[model samples]
Every structure is written in structure tokens, then in C-alpha cells.
Target chain A: MHISSTEVDYIALGASSDFRADGRHAFEFRDVIVESHLVPSVSGSSRAQVGGTDVLVYVKAELGPAQGKNGTEGVITFTAHYSSVTGLDNEVRTSNMLNAELEESLNRLFSEKQAANLERLCLLEGRVAWTLLVDVTVLKADGNVLDVASFAVRNALLSTLVPHVEVIRGEEGEADEIEVDDEPASRRLLLEGDPPVFISVCLLGSKWMLDASQDEEASMTSKLSVGVNSSGKVCGIVKAGEGALEWDGLGDTLKTAANMGVKIIEGLRKVQASRAETVGFFA
Target chain B: MGLREFDYGPLVSVERGTEVTTRERKRQWNELRPLFMRTRMVSHAAGSSYLEAENSKVICSVNGPLANTGGRTEAIERAKISCYISRTKFCGLEDDELEKRATTEYEGIVCRALESIVRVEQYPKSTIEVHVLVIEDDGSTLSAAITCACLALADAKIELRELMACCSVVNANGQLLLDPTLDEEKEASGSVLVSYLATSGKVSTVFQTGQLAYDEMAQAVELTISGAREIAVLVRNCLRQRESKDRGL
Candidate 1:
């Protein structure tokens, strides 16, 4: 993203005054609108329009045979596709590289010990289990895509329903055959664990901004995305873009992420609850 | 005897299993899925478009007429066209690994479809890149990608000799199906993807899987062209809307 001289100066002045180009505060985020059940074909899906950056997160659960040799818990898959919407889309290599980077950052956030509760998806101890696929699509990328995508994924999973399975023993002491419930109401709830939310902080000089827009993102020297759980614990850290940062300074920023992450989660929870007592996502 | 199985009647069409928007009546064989397209979504990219055809969603961005840094630019007469496709997985660290070969194969097809239409000689010693990403693959992905590539190219204001449009036809149970969904493609006896240069009315690219009788292929080709033309009008209108909007109309 190329910044003109005037734009650079505007950003620099904003940073000095702790104001942003879009008239946002140093630690403020743009308006984020999240809607779930955007893709009804999938098990669960949601779209998050964070300012100009729009990302759709979809969850699909599939059954697979046990893979731990003796069978273990199921797994969650994360994929982030940086579509051609970005300016670098013209460069085939750059587009591919950015898509890979997006996937890596998304995976790091979900690869933590409790990022997902896979054991609940296991139908049998060592025979059958469900593999949940989390797909993130960048429809419109205006910066801060990773954090926005993470929030969307968390929202999608909260409303996701896993199909109920009845395990029946085969005839005369044979293997167990799983039967999936046909009715939607019969499906069981998935994700009985805390969903991690990622917040990104852009460090420009002595000032840091939360949820930087594309222009601010371009001018920033460094970006750090920290994932926090409900317990205010740091689940993961993803250093995005190229920038310089002092170790001590960013640590305090991480603390900001922890505090704000909980607030963000609470905000999302409020949104979910307000919707819960009324119409659902599909409605 | 090993085991016995019972087959149920084919009552429900498979599109419902994917992303289907219910209406008073189902679309005809040659009719298209619900199409929503928007252009100029990206600031940095020269051209960009977002297209949603039913459940098949795609975003394509075009960049270039820029300098070719890669030594692979052996062509001096025409500008080089490069295509990149990024298919996301449903979940996990890795993305659509199984379709690695197929994705590259589609990239080649896209490049071939657009390379000729772009007046490469106009821009000397440069490269044009088209990047496409499939958000959801319900069906007719290649066709969606082709139309989007054209829209993005036009949005970028690239000098194009003509516009390209694409359609997917599948022959299943002796019936011609247009814009077959992923499930229909799986059940198809044969499938054909045709891209047409709408301005010249020329077939730019054709990819076929499975087999069809010669006459069936001929008839399918004609219907496929019709589908392409229908979509071409929509593509044209999308560009016109952008122009009108820019003029404050």
C-alpha cells in the first residue's frame, strides 16, 4: 500500500497528537458489524465487516476415521484466503505469499492448547470423530484482517451446532456404527471451551493504535496481534507486517490486548445475547 | 454375496444441499444462478471485483502493466499474463491441498482465456497479473473465476480487445445441466467449461471432463455460448453502473 507524502504527513501528525486519519483515538477500533449464518450451506458461518475490511468465516464439520493409530481427539482446521482484493493481487507470487501468511497467523491463533475443544467432537474413543474446518475469506481487505477474521470465527463457532451421533454396537460383539440425528433440533452443541479472540496493535513511534485501518497499517512500523481468552490469558501472539518494536513496550501493549480482548469478548457476548432472546442468525 | 444396499429415488435436486435460494420456480437448465457483482473494491489494485453466483463466491483483483522483474519474461511482443489462485480450506493450517494440481491447472486456463484479449504489445516489457480467490466453492467455480477476471480487468482499465464470459455445462442422465453445482458435477457423466470472448463471439477456452457424443458436445457448446452471452450482458451493465456512479448519476 503506497502512501502519498500528504497522507504520510497526516498520519505522522495524527500519531504525534495520538489521533488517527479517520479521526479515531490511539487505542480505538473502527465500527465492527458481525452477522452470523451468512453461508447457510455450511454448519455455521459469519461475516464481519470491520470498517472497509470484510471477512467471512465459515465452519464445516465432517466425519473422519481415527488417525492417532489407536484414535485420539478430533481436530480443528483453519484457513485464511487473502483474496485478490488487495493491491498486491496483481503480483501472483505476492498474492500467494500473503495468503500463506494469513493462514499461518490464523493457525497460530487456533493451534493453542485450548483454542478448540476437539474431544467433544469425538463420537468414539478411537474410531470415529469430527473434523471441524474453519474457513476465513477476505472479501474486502482494508487492513487489520487477521484480528477481524478471528472475531468472526469466534462468533461463527458460538452459534455452530454439531450433529448428534448415536453409537451402536455391531451384531454379536462387533464394531460400533454411528448414526447421525436427522433433525436439526436433535443436533448437539459444539465448542464447550473458551473461544480465543485476537486483537492487533500497531506501533508507530511512541504511539500505538488498536485495530489500525489500512492507511494506518501501512504507516505503522510494526504490528502485533495477541489472542486472549476469557481468563485474560494470552493464548497466542502473531507479529504481522514488517516493523521495529521494543520488547518492553509491546509487552505492555499485550496487557492492553488482554484487558481489551475481554471487553471485546463481552461486547460480542452482549450482541449474541440480544440476538439470542430474539431472532437467530438464519432468521 | 457380500452386502446389499437400497437406493432411494432422486427426488430432491442437489443444489439444496449446497447454497440454494428458494424461489417460486427453479431456474431453467440454461438459466444462471443468482449473480451479484461489484467492482472497484480494492484501493491498491488496478482493478478488482467481487462476484457471488449462488454459493460460488469469488474475488478477483488485477494489477499491472507494471515492470516485469521476473527473468521469465521472454516475450517481447505481447505483455505477459500471470494467474494465481488461492483456495482456502474449510479448516486447519493447510489450505485445499488436494486441489493443488487442479488450482494450477485452472490458473493456466484463466491466463489463456485473458492473455489474448489483453493488448500486451501496447505495454512494452511489462507483466499483467490476475489473482483470484474462491471463498466458497458450491459449483461452476472456473466459470465464476473467468467472468470475475474479465470484470477486474475492465475495472483496472486494462486495454482489452474484447470481454470474456464463461459457463459450465454438465450432461447428466442424458440431460444438459447448466451451471451445475458441485454435487451435480460429481454426479455428471460429462462436464464442459467454455469461455467465450463476447465481443468477438469466439470460444477462448474449453475444458471438458467425462465424455459426450459429438452431437451432444455441439449442442452443449451452443447452449454454453448462450449462457456466456447472458452473463456478458450482466458484466457489461456492472461496468456501466460503475461509470455512471463515478459521474454522479
Candidate 2:
């Protein structure tokens, strides 16, 4: 839904009074719960629930030959799907749009060059590389699904452990291979350069609200979802609703989103650090 | 005059000497009224609402005022309207005979009611989609559906020339009951579904099933129109409340 221009003014005024319908301060973040290693069968999985929005992400990495012109190195790809249990209109289309946005953001965040630099992800040069598949599901939607999904994906990837591979040659020109280890070992991805996180902010009444509820979403004049990194860098942006934003408000919203993105990234890092041992689906 | 009552667990067998009592029926009707009333259910969608009458619960969501598909976009004279009804698992998740019949009946009522009030010529070929999801069922499912759909369209903030509303009437013994709940539905001899444009007091659509006298049909229609008017008043008040809140008055 598009936000109307008048609604934008209303929200701006409402923010000044600190009288949000959901009773939250303009900059206050919602309660977020993140659980990692939820899917045991998959290499890694995590679920994050923020308010009424629930997102689940599963990561599976396999060693295979890298495709395309750059065959000499390794590659990593991410795919996402959106499905709805409730029969809301345009659910499929909305899910598809979110999936495409996430895929593009992840690809841009972790390019082919970065994957090769990660070392552990690449196996036997161009012949074999680890292709990571990240599947995200939105079970219940209240608001701010993009942020919850991003957090789940990042934590799932952190909990993932790729198997070790070794290539050995026989004495008489016969090729041979040996198992280095059966147990999986912990590993970390090179995420310092681009830790993209998404923030969905809505313009209501006359103020821009961060993490709106379902009711607030209906009343919003316009909404802007911006993807940013730990360094306050924007990776992508999506705008919807019937409202217009002035240059000043847009700029302020972006700044607020960037700051919120950094806090989210820091929170995720702490979650990863606190885990002593991996928890599987049952746990 | 009393509440309508019927057993939802199992159908009772009636013998020559055993007949359903009027007092028992009124008792059931009184029990079901609260479930049929709902106010401002959906937060998203331009307009949204849900109502539970007896055992039936339906939620309606409206989305539109955006770009329409195809070459018809040029004929910006009137808006297009489309209605879809989905019955969820709580209302018996199986694809059975009763579900199909209920959907077909509700869809017809919605199409007719919306077409009557919507300015179809305004947007030429574009369409405004109205989706209704039935989450639970007790009885009078289709009537509840029509009411919910109209409320949703209103919630979506769509411009409607007139407000629409619907209700179901059932013939039990010699009397007609308004908004029959799930239990009353099981014992009802027949049912009539009706939708009305409240502003003009015009009957947009009507459907009846089972045997009924000619006078009964007229009475049922009258009851439905009156019930619809009551619902319309509630919807208007809710919208006004929301507007007042937005204006900070």
C-alpha cells in the first residue's frame, strides 16, 4: 500500500508528541529473539522473531565445480523463498519481491572475489567450491520481516561448518583421495567488509516509525526499507505506500536507519560469540 | 424471541412424538449473537474486518488504488472490483461439497453487491481485489462473509459511493431468526442470504435454500436489510473513530 502525502505530515507531527499508536518511542527497537542451529539436517539454520514477525533461515553448502567464465576460482550463491500460511492477497508476489531483494543484497555483499579470499569455502581450485544455499521462510508476519530474515540468515551462516577436503595422487599416475576427518569443525565467514542488514521504516501521520505493527502498516502513508552495513553504508532501498517524503525527512530517515543497522549487526555478533557449542533443531 | 440453540457435536434424531421446542431454539439464538459482531479487525489492507456469527468466523482484506494491469489503464473512468473467498482449515480444511456450495453462494452475493455500488466506469478495465478468508465456521458462513468483505473494502480506504452490508435469516418452526448461529443453522429448515446498499436502501443480492412460504421470503429479506443497516452503522462509526484519532481530536 502507498502512503499519502498528508499521512506523512501527520506522522511527523505525531512523532513530535511521542504519541505513537503502538506506544513506542520514535527510535526504540522492538523485542527480537534469535535462535541458531534450528535445523539439524541442513548445514545450519536459525530463526528470529521480532514482535509478531517470525523468520526462519536454513543454510546448506555443497562442494561443486564453479560455473561461468571464472572457473579457476570458487563461488557462493544465495536463494530465498517466501510463502504464506494465511490467505492474504498478493502474498506470493510480495514474497517473490522480498526474495529477489535479499538475493541481490547477499550477492552484492559477498562477491566471487570475497568467496575465494575466505579460503575454507574453496576446494581444489576451479574444480570444486562450496555453494551455499540460504532458504528463508516467513511464517508469521506482523511487520519488519526484512530485518528479522536478515538476522536469521546471518546467524545461520555463522553456525555453518564446511567439511574439509583433500586431494592426493597415487604413485603410478592413478588419482587417489582420503578422508581427513569425519567430524565437522567450526569456521567463520569473512563478513567484516560488508555486513548488510535491512531496516524497514514507515512514514505515519507526520513521523517516520521504525518497525511498525500490522495496524500501523495499514495506516502508514509510505514506507522505506533500506539495507545497510555495519559502517552505515546502504546496499539497497525499497519504497512503498501512497506517501511522499521531503528531502529533509528522507535524509533523516536514512541516517536513523544506518544507526539502527549498526546496532543490529553488533547484536548479531554478540549472539554468535555467546554460543559455546552448536545447537541442533531439537534443541 | 428467546435464544436459538442446536447441538454442534452430533445431529439429533427426531421421531414422530419428539419435536424441537421453540424455547430451546431461542436459547441457542441468544448464545450466538456476540460471536457475529466484530470491529476493525485488520491493521493492513485499505479496509479490513472480521465477524463471527455462532460458529462461523470470516476475515476480509482489501488492497487497491495502485496501477492496474493491461491496456485498460487508459480508461481511467471507473474502478474494477474482484472478490475471492478462501475457507481455512479451522472451518474443516477438506475440499467437500458444503465448502464448494458455500463459496459459490458467497462469491455471487459479493460480486453483485460490489458491482452495484462501485463506479466500474471510473477505471475502465482496472480491478480492485477483495479477499476474504473464513477462519472458523459455526453457521451462516456466507452471510458473515458478505458483511466482513464490505468492512474490509471500507478499511482499505477505498472510495465507495455507498456502504454495503449483509446478513442471514433462517426459518425455524414458524418464525424467522436473524443472524442464525452454528447451532440454529443445523436445525433451520432453510436460510436466506441478503446484501443491501445501506445509503440507498437498495437490495443488491439475495439467495435462499430449502422450502419456505412466500411470506417468509419477504420477511427474511426485510430482516436481512435491517440487520445490514445495523452493521453499516457500526462500520461508519469505526471509520469515524479512526479518522478522529488520526486528526488528534
Candidate 3:
């Protein structure tokens, strides 16, 4: 939505006083509601709802030839699908830019950050490995879509289970034969350490706010998306928008984002630990 | 099997006795690769620059501020920028799809970084297009592309908020390596690239991948900024040389 200049002025005025349209203070985020393992057919699946934004992530594992120099390690690829209903039209270049930025951030989370140890997924070194395809679809986007998408991807990856594979040496000059154990009990999660979650901080007037709604996002001067894992380490950072940030403000923004990310990861862990059942979308 | 032939070959040798692959840096951690820059390399384009950072070579050309003939007038307040990045067949290891994907990603980053520094509002109802081609990509290709594009824009005499220089730092384990080579980058645990406007004390872009502690990430950012400052001086010198050459000095 194209917010008028008056609306932008109003939001800026409100932000200067630590007020927001949703009655949340600056540095506050809307509650994140997540449901994991919602799809039984896929290796793992999750749906996360943050404020009005809704995103779904599905992880599927397939056996494939190893890639590049990391022959002993498996590969995890991330692809984002923006549903047409999400109001992201191709004509508006800003939305397209947002989509590209979000996809790159997710790719960096798994491929560059080493969020998960992929060696466990390798069945036969330099020959066969489990290639995980993580697909994220944005069902609705009210703003802060990157954070919500990353949250769903991390949850989905945590629930992913890969089946055991036994490699049998073939006859001379022949390819190796493999057997996949399909027993439910034989499947197990291979990754160690939690994948990072993305936290976006937007400069609204003079205050840096978290989880800006679509309207608030339009009024922000610039935005920074910081990816931090549960262990209080920074995974990745991508800055967006047209506004340039001061040198001193960059440090403060990163510090605030790191603190907020750790707190949110802890909260998410507690929420997952206390969960009883899947209680998917219908519930 | 066909794609394997395009491989650039391993940078390290695996000893027959042990499996350790060791690579030693040729320069100090704070040292930047020797820079060679030239402007107006393409006579046809509005502005052009060819920059070589040691082995990484990039050529950029800027063509536009052309009148917006098509498309509905959406962003009339500021000029739009479209950036495209491509690599030559002999630039590096070849994977057609991967190269395409990398180019698109770099294009987005370069565009966004320049958008923040360029004075777009002055050229309303027009567009600025930047095209960058990588002749060689030893490492830090993204940083080189950014610098080359910035210089091209300046050579074109486009109005900008300030001249921006970019620097890249790679963290291998706990040690920070500035201006790492391809081998070093492959071994790095994390990497951070910062594009800074020294005069204004503003950061136009901060892109990072891999994982590091917050303090480490901060340190890397500071390192890149200082490194960028040094490069900014070099950029100024190159521009000055171009000016003198134009005056038949």
C-alpha cells in the first residue's frame, strides 16, 4: 500500500514518542506463533505466523551427487515462493527487491553460516549425499517477512528427519549400490546446533524499531536484517533501503539487534519445549 | 564429467604421507592487494572504468540518466538504477547456473549500495544503468565490482553524495584476513564486506555471511572501514590522474 505523506508524518511523529499503531513500544515484536511437522509426507514442515505475516516452510531430502569441493558434505538449498495473494506485484520494484533480499539472506543462513553440520547427511564420501531442499512460501506479508520466513525455515529444519542409507561396494569398474532403510524408527535428525533466526531493525525517524508492519515499513528510512543463532553469535547481516547509516549508529544497531536476537531465540526454545501437540493451521 | 574440465584446479597439494592442506598468505593481514584503476576504458559508454585488484579484474560501464520512455511513472521522485553483473568464461570455475545466480545477487547488492550514495533525486524521470563484467575473479569479486561501478559513475560525472570505497575481510577460524585470495576465501569461516563513504562517515552497505561472534563481526566491520578509507585515497588519486590526463598533462 502506498501510504500518503501525512500517514508517513504521523507514523514518524508517533515513533519519536515510542508509540506505534499496534500499541507496541519501540524494539517490541509481535508474538510469533509456530507449528512444526505439519506435513507428514515431507521430511519436515513448519508454519509460522508473526503479526499478520504468515509463512510456510517444507524441507525434503533427496539423494544426489556431491557438489563442488565439499564432496564429503551434503548441500542444503533454499528457495522462496511468494504467493500471488501476498500482494507482491512484479511492477512494484521494491517488493521484488524485498523478495530477492530475503532469498539471499536465507541462502547465507544455511550455506555460508554453516547453521547445520551437513557432514552427517553424507552417506558415501564424494559419491552420494542427501540434498535438502527447503522451500518457503509466503502466505501473507504484512511486513518483516524475512524474519518470519527464517523462523519457519529454522523450525522446519529442526524437525527434518533423514533415513539411514547403507552403501555397498559394487563389482569392479561399477558404481556403488546403496540401500535406504525406510523404517520409521531408522530416521533421525542429523544436524547439530540450532539454525539462526533473522531479526530486522528499521530506522523509523530517530528510533530503531523491531517488526515494522507494512505501513510502518513504508515510512522507515532504512532497515538492517541481522541473523543471529541461539548461541549468541552473529550469523549474517544484510542492510536494505535507501538511507545511509552513521558510523556510530551501526555499532549501536548491531548491539541492540544481537541482544534482541538472543532473547527471541531463548523465548522460541522455551515455547517449543513447552509445546504439547502439532495443533496445525486448523487449530 | 564435462563440467569438471572447467575446474580451476586445487590451490593446495595433499601430501602423500598426510592429509593436511596448508596455504600461506602472501601479504600481511592488514595489507590490501595492489590496485590498478583506469577510467574511460570504453569509448562508447557514458563512463567506463577497468579496475584490477591484484588478479581480480573487473570492467564497469555506466550508460544512462536517459529519459524514461516506457513504463508508467512510478518513482518520479528519484531516478531508478538497474545493475547487471556478468563473468567471462575464463574468469573462474564454470557452472553456468551458479555463475548466473551469483551475478544476479551481486547485481542487487551493487545496485542497492550505489542507490544510497548516488544523487538520484536530481535526475527525476530517468534511469541509470550499470553493467559490470568480471575478467578475473581471484576473490573479493563483489567488492571489486562495487568499486569499479562507483568509479564508472564518477567518470560519467554523475552527481553523488560522496565517493564510496568497498573492502572485504574474511575470518578464518579466529583470524581476520583482509583482501583474501580465492584459496583463503574458500577456507574462511566467515566473511564481511563493507562499503563506506569516508567523508560523510556513513556506511552505504554492510553484507556478511558465515558466523562469528558479535564482537568479531564488529571488529571485521571496523577493519573493512579502515581498509576502505585507504582504498578511497587510492580511488581519489586515480580520479586525479584521469583529470590530469584529460587536461593533456
Candidate 4:
């Protein structure tokens, strides 16, 4: 097998206690820049740029019939598209994988039981329901796409609002009615309980690094990504790269990831609360 | 709803400008009087630029000189340049004929010019890819795309021994005009596209369609060469600005 000199250096760095070219600790993450209400025309939108990875997500709600099994409930469907700024050739495969992973992760988080509590979204019992479509796009891919994508999706969802609904009797029969006023009078999701965040750890040699760059990813032997809910629970886990991991290391990584996920959720909550008070895109 | 049709004219033609007609074409061109002629607009890439020839706006971004995934290791001295032109929504139908012609012409121009300027043998197994995304267009889009791609390549920190630029000249109503607009393009009798290297003052590529006299071709070449220089200067300025910004200067 052929490998570049950079790869060799990255492996050596991973083995040493003093890892990362930027001097960041193994558990440290790069600064994240998050912005909400980017697309004014859409119901809600948010963009997040973490390190070099960029993600934009928009939330739009439409009225549809509720499922027979899940009466008096609404639906939230998350669709993600990842496109790289670097060019189509380099990003096609990575984008597809990230999209599928993000969609699955979000679906797992917003279970039918949790969605039933959103009574304001349901128009009538087993009749009409509000379906929120969360569209996520990955414009630039430097590294850590999953984290950035999840951040944007969650932020967009937090910013989204579904209009008030009421049931009325018509001339023919009883009908479900939706009153969508210009004013922002809509219910917000209680995402504080079930919010999930993803943490990716790449094994350089014996040491694991958080938020690895594209070059570092190429050099690393294996990468373990863990999805943890707001309640410090491990929701999902996936391992990628060329090497295998020991059970002890995996267990330790999972514990570290859970702690990291909680920190992320706290940070997001702070941003969402403060951001909701603010008005304009640039401001 | 589908993509909306673009109206090139003013919202209120009588209030702002005269109506578009065959006889009023020259008058319209004379009135618009572009602020800048063939100026290089960007400067960060190995090559970067913008070609504002009349109403047409072309911005080019080039990135490479990093590595080549494929190619012979021994023949590393030469670099590979790929050109992509994003058509405007108004281009209407997406046809194979237009795409083939544009790609072939672009490949011919870039390949001929880079062959002489790039030290490809030094990096045998490597290639430099060039991508040109066109945000808007008025006329002679292909020629402008070639020029923009060259500038973007320069901005991307790629190594090129010389600067390459392209421009189009058309024959209109028995008179030759440099940088025709979309309206003029429809009525033009013939068109000549030329790509030139500023450092060597050499013509790398030339495509002339429709019948034109030898003297007419020479005149068009002369006009395009001078226009290329003006554009080269703009490209340099854009790069300088970006460099300064990057350095926090």
C-alpha cells in the first residue's frame, strides 16, 4: 500500500500525548459559528459552520391527513442533502452517507410517542395534521459533517413554528380548520428533553482526536461516531476507517462521547434561547 | 411554479430606455457604455478574474496545484486543466450539441496554452483541475468562461508561467464590434473567439464561425489582444486585494 508523508506524521502525532497540528487536546473541539433565520422566505432556517464543514437547514410545514395508527398526532419528516463546495467528484459519496445517517438519527430521536404531545399541530382526530419537513444541505465539507449537519437541523427545528388549529362545524359537516395569521403565534417543540448530538472521534494511532480535518481523516486508521441524547444516553454508534478497536477503548470513547453530547446540547440551548430574542439575519 | 422567464429589458422601457429593435442595437450599446473594459475581477486563486465585457458578468474561481489522483508519475511536468461553464436559466433547452462544442473548444484552448506554460514534467503523476462557475451572462459566454477559468486557476495558488485570457469579437452590419451583447449576438454576421497569453503575447486558441475576410480576422485579433491585457490587470488587482485581506494588511 502507498501512503503520503502527511499520513505518517498524523499517525505519529496520534500516538503522542501532544496530538493535533493546532495543539488542541484529544477531547477538544473547534469553535462553532451558528446563525438562525437565514432564509427569510422559508418558515424557519438555520446555518452552522463548524471548522470547515458547513450546513444549512430549512423547516417548512404543510397540512396532511394523520395516520390511522397515530390519531390526533402530527408528523415531522427530516430530509437531508449534502453537497460539497470542493466539487462534486470529491463529495458525492461522503454527502450520500452523511445524508442517510442524519435522516436516520433524527427519525430515531423524534419517535411517534414523543410527537403525540404536539397537540397544536393536529387539526382533528385522525383527520388533518401538520407535517414539518426539515431539509438539510451540506454546502462545504472540510470535516465533521455529521456534527455540523445535526447542529443546523436542530437549530432550524427550534426556530420553526406550526400555526394554530381549530375544529369547526361547516354547512355540510364538521371540518378541521387552520388559522395561519401573519403574526408568529405558533407552538414550539419541547426539544430540551430528547435533543441528540453526534460526537466523532478519530483514532490517529493510540490516541483519539475530536473534529479531525480531511487530511487527518485520510491519515487516521479508524473513526468512531457516537450519538447521544440529551439525557446522557447513547442512541447510536458507528465505527469507520481501516482499523479495528478494542472493547475497552470503545467503552471509554462512548463514555466520553456521552459527556460531550450533553455539553453540546447545553450550548445549543443557550444559543437557541438567546437567538430567539434577536431579530435580523446579520444582526 | 417552474423557473420564471428572465426579461432582459428595463421594467419600464419608455421611462428608462428605448425599446429593443434591430436599428436601435448600436444606439443601445453606445448608451450602456460599460464602466470597465475586460477587467480581471478576482485575485485569490492560483488564477482569478472577472470579465465585464459589456453587460456580461463573469466571475471565475480556480483552486489546485495540490495533487493529482491519476496520471503517469514520470510525466508529472504537465498539469491537467478542466473547464466547466454553468449556463444561466435563460439558456432554455439543455442540448448535447451546445455542450460538446463548448467543452471541446474549452479543452482545446486550455490544453494548448498550459502545454507551453506549465512545468508538468516536474509533477508527473499530478493534475491541476480548473472549475469555472458562471453566475450570469449576456453574450460570448464561452469566451468569457475560458478567461474566468484561467484567472481562477491563478487565484488558487497554482503555478502558471504565463497569464491566459479570452474574448470574442463579432461582425455587425458590415462593421466589427468588440464584445457584443446578447441582442447584438443574435444579429451578428460572424463571430471570432480568441484566447491569448499575456506574458508571451501568443494566441493559444482561435474559433471563427461564419464567413469573414482575412483583414477582418486580423482586426478582431488586435482588438481582443488589447482587451485581454485590460482584463489581466483587473484579475491581478482582485488577487492583490484578496492577498491583502488574507494577511490582515
Report, in order, each candidate's fnat.
Answer: 0.00, 0.00, 0.80, 0.00
Candidate 3 or 1, higher lDDT:
3
Query: B96-210, model 2: which lDDT tens digit per residue?
Result: 5443343533454475567666656655546788888888876667767776776666666666677777777777775777777666666666666666677766555555544
In model 2 chain A, which range of ten residues has the least summed lDDT? A108-117
Off by over 4 Å in 2: A1-16, A72-76, A86-120, A167-180, A185-194, A276-283, B1-249
Q: Tens-digit lDDT track for model 1 on B1-249?
A: 221122111122324344354321366676677688878666688898878776788889999978877664255556878889876674121343443335544676677678657777788778899999887877788889989999999989999888778888887787888888776765676666777777767666655444333345556767887888888878888888777766878
Model 4 residue A178 distance off true place after TM-score fit, in angstroms: 4.1
Model 1 stretches with alpha carbons more than 4 Å out: A68-70, A85-89, A92-94, A169-172, A274-283, B1-249
TM-scores, one per candidate: 0.52, 0.48, 0.89, 0.48
The deviation in Å at residue A54 for candidate 2 is 0.5
RMSD of each: 21.9, 23.2, 7.0, 22.1
Better of 1 and 3 by TM-score: 3
State the lDDT at A2 in candidate 2. 34
For residues B36-111, what per-residue lDDT tens digits would candidate 3 score against the true structure?
Answer: 8878778788888888876799999999988887767367777999998888888875575444355556778899
Interface C-alpha root-mean-square deviation, candidates in order:
23.2, 26.2, 1.8, 28.6
Question: Backbone collision count in every prediction?
Answer: 8, 48, 0, 36
Tens-place lDDT per residue, model 2, A9-118, is 66556666777766788777888899987777887789999987888888787766754334554555666555655223453335344456555544434432322244
In model 1, the Cα lDDT at residue B7 comes to 16
Q: Tell me the lDDT of model 4 at A148.
A: 76
Error of 4 at A265 (Å): 1.0
